[model samples]
Target: MPSVGIEGPVVSRGLDGDGAVEAPPFGNANEIGWYRGGARPGAAGVAVFVGHMDTRAKPAVFYRLGDVRPGEEVTVTRADGRTAVFTVERVETVAKDDFDAQRVYGQHKRGRAEIRLLTCGGAYEPEERSYTGNLVVSGYLTRTGTG
Candidate 1:
């Protein structure tokens, strides 16, 4: 997306039996992973895209995601060659422990196309090999165009 200034293949990620969505590998920092079970971009639901915030030695594609502000534009190119244009509505950082499944994954409004861009945030724990919080950017579809 323009705000992030990078783009890569978005692979489908499915939920496991525990109903948890698996994140992309750390080595694939350049690409984004889409929750295949969630709404597709430009569709009437929440489409989720996730990327790595940082690696052990360097920053990843979404290291700057926390800096994105409301009103910024986020564009997603669909497999059908159509572009889904979105306007950022809000940005939030919530602790992983307090992550609200319903708020993040639930549909906000009926018939409204929305998206969530997610990445790691807060303190990183070396022992745990994970961040304490998640950086989420919520956007709503503003328009569509040919890619």
Candidate 2:
């Protein structure tokens, strides 16, 4: 299960790979689920969380993620009691192979905190190819609820 505070929020593994898997509003998937090629929070790299916009039967947890506009606020509570909040800076669509993990998850030169959200996008395939690309939401850290 994903980590959450007693009074904060709860997130669980999303079903159908749609990543309905929920964590704290902005928690990294690694802290909550099994993700390949990523490190834990505060591990000297940008943590990434990924989910699906929709499943065959229903929309995933991050279904509404794409609805978040730039300047929106996303709050993630770390296990250490430090809440790493992020402000949505940009949202972009990229082909699967073209999705650059380093560019998206690597540390920034400006020494600012950052986070990334990923999901399948760019047209849904019914049975063969499920998704065409990834919808990435990028943000930098800030105080919670402040955009």
Best by lDDT: 1
Clashing residue pairs in candidate 2 (N, C-alpha, C atoms within 3 angstroms): 11-22, 13-21, 14-20, 14-21, 18-52, 20-61
Residue ranges of candidate 1 with Cα displaced over 4 Å: 16-18
lDDT of 1 at 14: 79
Q: What lDDT does the true structure give each of the candidates?
A: 0.86, 0.57
lDDT of 1 by residue, 66-139 (tens): 87899999988999999999998989988989999888877677789999988888898999999899988999
Per-candidate TM equals 0.92, 0.66
- Name the lDDT value of residue 46 in candidate 2: 61
Best by TM-score: 1
In the range 97-125, model 2's lDDT, one tens digit per residue, is 68665676666645555677776677776
Cα lDDT, model 1, residue 6: 57
